[model samples]
Target: MAQPIIEFKNFGFQYDAQAEPTLYNIDLAIQPGERVLIAGPSGSGKSTIASCINGLIPFSYPGRCTGSLTVDGVDAPNASIFELSKHVGTVLQDPDGQFIGLTVGEDIAFALENQCVAQPEMKQTVERVARLVDVENLLEQEPHALSGGQKQRVSLAGVMVDDVKVLLFDEPLANLDPAAGKQTIELIDQVQQKTGATVIIIEHRLEDVLWRSVDRIVLMGEGRILADTTPEALLAGNQLAENGIREPLYITALKYAGVSLEAEKKPAHVDTLRLTEQDKAAVRTWYQQTVARPQAPAAAPLLEVKDLCFGYSEGVTNLRDVSFTLNEGDMVSIVGRNGAGKSTLAKLICGFETPRSGSVWLNGRNLEGDTIKERAAHIGYVMQNPNQMISQSLIFDEVALGLRTAKLPEDEVERRVNEALTICGLYPFRKWPVSALSFGQKKRVTIASVLVMQPKVLILDEPTAGQDFRHYTEIMEFLRSLNQKGYTVIMVTHDMHLMLEYTSRALVFNQSRMIGDLTPAELLCDSTLVEQAALKETSLFTLAQKCGIQPPEAFVQHFIDYDREVRDKWQTV
Candidate 1:
């Protein structure tokens, strides 16, 4: 049994500032050389548990503890953070926050230097780990200048050089593109196998995490362990749906077709799932019987970008000859790999950045003369992080901040704020403190603040980056409702599922060029374009092929239509 490298016996913790304990009676154990995944919705105490294991609760957070906890044979409550650092290494969600050294090689060697290892020995170890994580070529590059995926690899190498017994990864895929995310999972698997270290991953993207095989899954919600079991057993039950976690896409498709799932069949991984003739027949029949709804007619062009080209520096172009027309009442997704000019396009449209050789037109009016504030009336851009957008402490004040700045009458400000709050489903909490809301709720508050500006177009950057399936659905559906209300919606995102399910159109970018502008199904069906844009094909496409469904794109479109219909009915109920 390897003495269970990490154990929590009815352990609980509450920060001094918090009245109630974040974790409640958490009983968990992780054996040596094991790969375990911990997943839950927002406020589920998964982060609190990770803090306890990493020696941040008592040492850094100043919290009261109950019961007992141990990590790598050390009493976590009694051990100093410096002591625990020897046995457990943590990779944070944002890799940028953890980099201390300027260069990649320097960052990886920082830990060894602190221990005062011989220069020759430290160099050998750093090079070995850099090669192990495939960051050897990036040794001389600046850490912050690297891409999201590269930064993650450097963070991993920085920790691995310590020779720690356990590795803790907190939301490692939160900011990566699709291809980068897959590579990250593969890299993590390689590191675990080569090092024989105990691995614990805390992430909300269960489906993506299942890209690699895991020994067990720990599901948590409301400060308690809801289920601690193998991936197959957990997927075979209703716990994931009950706790707001998303299962693998193929499993959900099989369930939609009324195919029964059994743990023995290994429904966790798509490649190894044992499907029978009955299952194939069920999926084929369901696909054949389902008919896709007709797409709506395209509306008039509301915003137009004419041959836009912009560069921050002399020779480094951010956007090159980018042109697109956003029609009224349209919901479009702008997607690509990291640093693919998606955010830059939004900035140009919002007048934050001037295009070197282009023009922007809104309803046949040139916006070149408009200032950043003047453009706000026609276009609203909501940043990815709600904290960056929110300024006021109360919900009402936050939503009304923009309207009040314009010196609107008191009655008009109240009416506009109330209207926006109601649309965002936050009217009931209008007077509540902003800090009291959940992450998703705060995101909605940010959107409400934008909606009050009465903009014709709403641009959101990664609207559901860190959200679970339940919150993702809520936020996307709310945006869909707004799109239905004749507001043009543009989303700059990396979520392929959101693009395929919630959006009708997709604008694909590659190397700072608009490579493909097509339907989401069309884009996913073209493997060459998907690869070029650094996007992964949906599992539904593979499932369609396995079931002998003709023209996999049609099957995907049918699934999208059927899923939306089901959600629409559920919402009505």
Candidate 2:
């Protein structure tokens, strides 16, 4: 048997300023060359454990540590971060936060330079790692100027430049498009095979991570390991759902069909999971039972863009000749690969960017003449990074800022603030200090702040990025409620589940152009569109295909309809 490369024995950790420990007594072991996934909902202490493995808990976070923890045989608490860096390389959740170099090549070479390696050797190592991560062309480009997905890849290249024995990735797929996300998982597998490193991935996208086989999954909740087992055994039961973690959609579909997999010992990979004839029949029966809901005719357009063209500078256009109309009460999603101009289009709609030669109309009023603040009355834009949007120290004050700025009466401001907080599930934390909140909590603060303004059209960029499953549902349900009340909601996101489960329409962008505008089902069903837009087919679609269903697209459509029906029923109840 191989010795454990990473081990935790009765380990506990608490921040110095907190009254309670963030991590409970944890006992885990990952042998050399093993790949492990640390998964949990937001605030579940999975990140804290990753910090411990990277020697950031004691050295940087000022945390109290108890029990033994070791990484690559080095005592973690006592070892300096510099010493731990020799054995462990960490890619943080925020790639921007981890970058220090101006250019991609410089960033990747920073670690090598710290070791005082000769310039020639450093250059060679940087080039090799850049090739490994497929960022060779981005070497000379500024890291900060790159897209979110590109920045993530640069971060990976920087960490892989060093020959570390253990690699830690924190939410690596959080900002990636589905296609890029799939490629990232494949790259991780290749890196593991080539380096024989003990790789630990901390992420919430379990299905994406499950694209490649993992030795074990260390499930955490409130700082303790809930289940440390193989994916097959883990998904064989309802533990994940019970713990507020999202099970794969296919598995959920199977459960909905009343199919049991308790007797099966095979892996849960959709391609490999063999269903009995009865199971197949049950799935078909469920599909047959699903009734498609009638679509209500769309209201008149609330926001319209015509012949819109925008460029950051001469010869660099981000959006060109873009045209779209969004109707009142419509829930729409804009999706594409990173740097595909999805966000640029949102900014244009919200009056953050001036068009070169086009116009935006909101309810027959021209938005080109309106200032950003003036446009705020009709459009609220929640930025992708919560840090950029948050301004106040207290959660309540933050939410109330926009309302107060509008000179609303104090009583009205208070009422609106409280209501927005309640809707975003941040009411209990209204009085809490913003600095004390987790990333997801802070995201809710920004959302509540926008919701208080009561804009006619709400545009959110990756609204559920850092959120947990419970919060994702809560936020989406809130948006659904707003949609029912005739508010227009638009989201720019990479989450296929969100696109399919929430939005009725999708506008697909590629290279600063809208390539396809159709229902989410149509976009997903058309393989060419999915590939051209850099999106992946949903696992539910794959499940239907594996079940030998004819015209898998119809099954996918039925599932979506069924899901919406169930959600509506839950909301009414």
Candidate 3:
């Protein structure tokens, strides 16, 4: 029998200088060339399992490891991080912190340099890995200057150059736009096919990547792997959601159609579930009705944009000749390719940046005159990186910071802070030190911090970037509840999944212009517009096509309405 490339036999681990083990008895194995998607909810010990493959647990993290965890032929606990590098290559969640070079080319070469590769051979290796990760065109660019997706691709190239037998990707698509994220997944599939390396991926959005290719899916929660099965079988069960794993929208749709485990034998996964004439007809009829009629465009602008334009530098024009209006209760998504000034536009409308020209009127008040603090009375902006928004050492204090900063009464602060914590799903951990939390938990603290302020409009930048399915739903469900209470939300995101599932309207940005503003179904149907804006048509739509459904409008709209309120924010541009 062929030796397994990665094996975790009844393994458990605890960080050094810590009280309890973070992981307990994780049993997993992967043969050479197998692709496994390791996924679970926030704080599920998913990261801990991936760390063992790279020897990060016992080396950099300093932990007590039990049983056996091996990569290639060596035991992980017995090897230093450097020694394990010979057999394993790791790509971390945050691409910014892993850079070792000023330029993309240099970054990929750094690992090769450390290996003492010949100068001529190193040049060839850099070229080889660049193509492997699809960053060949970015070789001469500065690492810091690249977009979030580009930065991740460069990081992948750095690891691939080493030709390590085992490859581990930790949330590789977290910060990527839909288009880039799909391309990256395709690259992983290509790399595996060509090199036959053992690939293990940890991600929140499984359907977007690793779809039919993943050999197995491991679900974890509260420091243990609760279930291990093929992707299709795992998604077919609602039990995963109970276990803190969020099932994909398409799977949930299957459940709703009476094809669920409760009604019929769950066919392992949606891929193997098999579509029937009735299944196709039921799904098809819904699609035809939705596509035939999408609630007639809403009128009477809620927020008007009169030739609104913004820029950050002398020669660059971020938003040019942008004119549009959003009505009350409109859940709008502002989307664009990387560096198309999507974030810049969010800053302008929210008063973080003063527009160079034109006006963004919110309730008849031009946004330019208001300070971000004054705008906070109506608009709350959640920064993309939660680390930047976090200030207090403890979770409770962090959420209370806005209220405290306003010098609110003790009674008012306590009442409001607790409410926000509960809404953001951080109520139980309110007293926990902020440092003890995972990345997703840190993000929740930031959301709770902003929500306590009670703004009329909320702007979330990449809210679900690092979250798994379960937490993604928790946050969005809260936002939907808030929207029901009359909070207008405008999100700036690269996640088309979030856009489809939550927003009422889309503000498509391309070439530094507000190309078009349309409904989610309209946006997905326009292949040219989606591509121009650097987004891929969602996988649900693609899968529906495979099943021969016309347009898949119902499935597309299912996600759009999942987190919305019925009160129409009916403004279209």
Candidate 4:
């Protein structure tokens, strides 16, 4: 039998500044050439474990490490990062952060250059790895100028150029669109197979990572490994939700309808999860019992755009003659591929960028000359990166900064800030330092800051990107409540679930053009539109097809409506 490539025995890790250990008593082993997924909610120590494997802990993070961790027969804690790099290669969440070279080819050849490989050999190796990762055409391009997916491919090439024995991916799919994310997972699978490397992926999107089969899934929570098992067994029960991890939505739907996976034949993959005739009957019955609440008729338009055209330069157009109308109380999602101009549209609307041609009108007034600050009164734009929006050191101070800036009375500021914090589920952590909060929590703080202002239009870009199921639901539910209370919400997101479960309408963009403005159901059901927009068919839709349901579109719609109804009732309770 082959020796394990990675092993951990009673591992515990604590930062120098932290009073309590972040990871507690983790015991795990990965055999050679095995692919493993480590998944949990934000702040659950998934990344810490990855850091340990890549020799980032104790060495780079100033953390206290205990117990034993070995990577390819080397003690990880005592080994230098350089020593570990020869055996284990790490791909970070942000592709841009990993790039140290000016161009893709240079980046791929970096490790070889450090190893003092012959010039000819280094060039050959860079070309070979670039071709393997399908980034050969991007070799001459600036690493930072490529799309998110392309940058990821470049990062993969750079790491794999070394032919390391173990490859680690940290939140690989976090910043990608649905199609790109799926492709990235496929690429990872290909690399693992080709190199016969032990692969470990730390991600929050388990279902997405499950696009390709993995050897095992290690679910973590509150700094401990709760379950390490086959994907079939791990998802067969409520273990995921119990540990604050999100199981696939289709599984959640089946569970809600009282279908039992225990009695059914266990399928290896979620896509292959088959429902019995009786189980189908139960789901149909649940659908019949649930009633979807009708949305209120939209009021007069609050925001209108006409012939909007903008670009960073004359030849490059981000938005081309885009026109859309957002009515009062509308909850709309702007979705498409990575470079589909979703954020560009948001910036144009929020007055961060002036349109080269055409006009934007708010409440019948032209916003062409409005400054970003002037527009902030009516439109609140929360960037995808919370770091850009966060400025205050304390959570309470951050949320209340907007109110205080307006010179609101002390009592008014206190009441509104606390109210926003409570809505965002951050009141409990209101006193905590902003620096100590996780990425998801900081996202909530930024949202709370915006919520206190009570802007007529709230535009959030990828609001739940790095968040867990619990926080994602909380933030979406809060946004839904605000929409009901007459705030127009526009979300720029790649999460198909978010669009289907919450938004009433979707504005689909492709190649800087708004191709379709339709209901989520309409957009998802049309395969042509989904393909053109670089969106994936929802797993619910795929499930219906796999189950041999006739009129699969109708089944998808029914499931979506049923889910919305259940969510509404649950929120109320």
Candidate 5:
């Protein structure tokens, strides 16, 4: 048998500033040419493990370490980051933040150039790695000008040029659209197969990661390794839900239909799952017997956009003839590929950009004359990047900034800010420094900052992007409650499940055009629209088809309705 390329033997680590060890007695091993997924909720210590593997924990983070860890036959804790860099190359969550050169070629060659390699050798190496990542043609383009998926590929090329033995990807799918994300996963598989490199992926999107086969899954929680097993074995159990990780939608659907998840059935991947006659019968019976609740009546229009046309440059359209009405007490999702103008639409409505020849009306009042500040009174926009919105050092101060800016009384400001923090599940950390929080927590802080403004219409851009399923549920449920209380909510997001579960209607955009306006189920069930918008069909649809359920869209909607009913009951309890 081949030796383990990476091994951790009863390892433990504690940050200098932290009171307790973040990782506890972790023992793991990864063989060469293996693909393993590390999954857990926020604060699960999975990131800490990544830091240790990359020689960042004891080096950059300055922590006390116990036990031993090795990567590529070198001791990790005692190794310099530069030494480990030769063996481990990481692609970070935000590909834009990792760019260091002006052009794609320069960025990929930066590491080699730093080593003082000859120009001729460097050029050959850069072209080879760029071709490996399928980015050879994009070498001359500015890294920032590339699309999200293209940027990610550039990031991968930048690392692959090093000829590292292990590839570490930190949440590579977080900012990508569905099609882009799928393509990224496929690219990672191809790169791994050709190079025979060990791959370690740290991600919260378990279902998406499973789109490509993985050798094993390491589930962690509370600073402990909960389970390390094959994906098939892991998905056949309750560890994911117990640890606050979201299982695949189809798995949940199967469980809902009382279909047992036998290991032999291969529940890990939808395409490979071996369904039985009894399982099909069970799903069919459940669908036939289940009664879907009637959808709520449409509310009166509270906001409207007509003939909206916009572009950053003259004669080049980013959004064209786009129009939609947002009714009072409605929750809708705007979904599409990145740069499909979803965020542009939100910006136009919020008065950040003036439409070329369009108008916005709120409550029969023309908002064309409203300034950005004036629009704030009726509309709240929470940006996707928290760093762009946060201006305070502490969480409490940040959340209260909007309220104080409005000249609310100090006592009232405190009341509203605390309430918003509670709703966002950030009240416990209200006194903490903003820099001390995780990316997900910072995202919640931004949401809380907006929630305190008490706008009539709330527009959130990827509100749940960096969050775990637990926090995602909390924020969405709070938004649902707000909708019930007459706040119209619009979410610009790439999360298909969020659209299917939390939203009643979806506006699909593609190529700067509003392509489809329909229910979430209807949008996902139509293959043409799904493909056009770069959206993937929900696994629940595939499950329905496998079970011989007629009109798969109904079954999808029925599952959503039934799931929401159960969730609502749980909330009431």
Candidate 6:
């Protein structure tokens, strides 16, 4: 092993306002130019670990620390955040806070300017990093308008402009669509290969980020570093489920086929499937006999859309004769390519956007002319970006806003707010300033605020966009509870995994038309429909094709069973 650029020696920390330490007896080391991913379920302190590297934990966070954490050969116990900033460039999960410049170029040069770099040289350096991140054309655009993926890259460019030795990313894939998430991971790989900067990524989307480029995976659980192993070894291990995180879809599929790691005789994914036609036939036979397909739910329609032709501006059709029904107690997800009317339908249902020549019915009542306030009684809508919905500074106050509007008693407001905070895993920071919380935490707060309202129908627009695995599961489990209790839950998302697990129905949108309202299995099986809707098949679904078998219904059923089990386990006691 080479000399470690970073080291943690018996490190332990507790936020000044926290009752218990977030990280306990942490001991780790990172060699120079090594790319490491620190991952775990929600509340495992992955983001806190990033703070220690960037000198935010012991200083900005006002926390108590024992022992030492050193980065770039300097002990964190004594170094100031400004000092740490020179060596460790950080791109926070939320790009909104990270962007200081009114323009893309100016935002990238903010840190450089503070360092007293010459103006002429700053221009050259900013342009270089922006182009490297493929945001050159967006240099003059406002950061607010860029999509999730572009904003994340801009944040990375801003960090790289200072030429730091180590780069830290906290949940870089949280908000991006799957395609964008994959691209960001690829970009990180290309950048590391080119610069060899010691990169440490803290994220929950391990299935996408666990590429061959990363050297090791650091798994955190219950305030402890449980396992620091190669991604392959960790996936093959038994502890992933105990930590409340979803295993990769490929591993889960193999397990469903009654194949165990021990029986595979140390085989990698490539070696498991022989290319011989006979061997492929045997695998297909096993799946066909073993897997059972789950039947789609049997129920009456809960919400129906009829001839929903809608558009905001002239000549641009957002929704054209869109018609679909959401069954009672159903968890249906809408998946399509960008600008594919997924959000437009959600807005129409929530009464934010009215249809030009159609009607939206909720439980047999037409939504037309119903004030957003009237619709609010049944549907709780959370937008794509949490920033747009967030208005309060304190966490509890934000969660209680709707309850207060109803003129609930003070004690009743506290009760609902506290319950919501706990369900969303934000109770510990209930009184903290929303600005002080990290982006992932803020996303959780937004959900908690809505759940507190207890609406009969909850429509979440890209709720898991910038979430880590823990946060992702927390939300899915929460929604499952709502669905089980007979709330018709609908999510507008580009995440296929969310649909596969929680959704009872799948809606495909493309070219401003409601293409097909089908099951996840059906949607994946019809590759043409998926392509038309600008969606991709699950890796497992695609792998099944290579194995010479159609996707088995049993695999999809098993996924729902597993999701239900997780939901049952995580509910508030």
Q: Pick the TM-score winner.
A: 1
Backbone clash tally for model 3?
8
TM-score of 6: 0.81
Candidate 1's error at 109, in angstroms?
A: 2.0
For residues 1-573, write the lDDT of model 1, one tens digit per residue. Answer: 469999999998888989898999989989999999999988899888988888898878998999999898999999998889999999998999999998999999999999999999999999999999999999999999998889999999999887999999999998988888888899899999899999999998888888999999999999999999999999998899888888777888898899999998888887788889999999998888755586688689999998999999998998999888888998999999899999999999999999999899999999999999999988999999999988899999999999999999999999999999999999999999999998889999999999999999999999999888888988998999999888999999999999998888999998899999999988988899989988888888888888888899888888888888887888889
lDDT of 6 by residue, 255-358 (tens): 65555554133322433433445545544655555333355568787788899998889998988998877777888888886677888888888888878998
Clashes of 6: 6
Compared with the true structure, all predictions reach lDDT values of 0.91, 0.87, 0.77, 0.87, 0.91, 0.78
| Per-residue accuracy of model 5 over 1-573 as CA lDDT, tens digit each | 799999999999999989999999999999999999999998899889999999887988998999999999999999999999999999999999999999999999999989999999999999999989999999999999999999999999998888999999999999999999999999999999999999999998899999999999999999999999999999999999988999999999999889999779999999889999999999988887656586688678899988899999988899999888878888999999988999999999999998988898999899988899889978999887789999999999999997788899999999999898887788899899999987767877887887788788999999888678987887788778778867789999999999999998999999999999999998999999999999999998899889988799999999999898888788889
The true-versus-predicted C-alpha distance at residue 141 of model 2, in Å, is: 2.7
Every model's TM-score: 0.97, 0.94, 0.86, 0.93, 0.95, 0.81
RMSD (CA, Å), candidate 3 to true, equals 5.0
Model 3 spans > 4 angstroms off: 16-19, 236-239, 260-274, 282-302, 393-454, 540-551, 558-573
Lowest-sum lDDT 10-residue window in model 6: 262-271
Task: Give the winner by TM-score: 1 or 3.
Answer: 1
Question: What's the CA error at residue 420 for candidate 1, in Å?
Answer: 1.7
Error of 3 at 71 (Å): 1.3
> What are the clashing pairs of model 1?
none
Candidate 4, residues 455-549: lDDT per residue as tens digits? 88999989888778888887788788878878899999999889988887999999999999998877887899999998987777766665556
- Per-residue lDDT of 272 in model 4: 66
What TM-score does candidate 3 get on C-alpha atoms? 0.86
The superposed Cα distance between candidate 5 and the true structure at residue 210, in angstroms, equals 0.9
